[model samples]
Target: MSDAPGPDQAGPQTQLPDPPRPPLPPTAPERGGPRARLLGIAGLVLTVLFLPAGLVLSIAALVTGVRSRKRARRVLAPAPGAVAGIVLAVISLVLALSQITLYAIAWDDLNGYVTCRESALTIDDKKTCQDEYLPRIEHRFHLPKGSLRQDPSWP
Candidate 1:
């Protein structure tokens, strides 16, 4: 006496149309245009890992990051790695510049210190080397007297 359809009995089925999907945004930054993630990562690695090439690579990273940001803005898309890349590049640039300055300004002094330390045969000899190095270096920087003390582990 059941009115419902039974097994093997076909019932009337009406399919509803799929819900309308909102169209994608105007443009996707992550989609098709030149991806800057590789550059960003390369710049970051160069800055942190290889300082010899960091001076050049840092500048490259900075330029690429800035360009990426500009391009993203021009296209009105969100930038993913631009800001991070720029920040890291700036830090690396500073470190690279400082390294260059130290080498350029105190090359002879540093060379002398290394040679003296290498030839030192005893703790007293090393201490003497430290004494000579500290004064010269302090004078170069115009540091106040007693500003820098010799390391106890000069050996």
Candidate 2:
């Protein structure tokens, strides 16, 4: 006589209750403690500094902040300052490498000039060899091979 089906025919109510709510999202950093804020700030700054030492410090600060925030049940956010520090460090390294590359290019040119002169001298073109090569090598390196037979001086 009941309109609803009995348990055997109901098929477990067809609709489930809402799943238990997920843990609430953390509130923003303003809700965190002073120490957490400081760690975040420090991490951001060190990352910007870009130096090897700065990078190390920045990483430490970031780790500290993350740990502290987790313990405090606060929201954690990446600091812009730390990101800048990391960028700076990378740029500095790149610049150093570029400078080295330029110096290597110049050095190679100088070596080529010296080698050409040595070849000329081997063919008894002493005047051409000395005029084109010797002074430059002596001025730059402060020494030149005295005898080709004994010193190849490729390096």
TM-score each candidate: 0.63, 0.25
Against the correct fold, how does model 2 do in TM-score?
0.25
Compose the digit string of candidate 1's lDDT tens values, residues 52-130: 6766766776777777677788878877766776777777788777777877887887788889999999999987887
Evaluate all candidate structures by whole-model CA lDDT and list the values in order: 0.70, 0.49
lDDT tens digits by residue: candidate 2, 20-119: 9998754443233344344445544544454444445445544544454454444345332333333443444454455456557557556666677667
**Worst 10-residue lDDT window, candidate 1:** 28-37
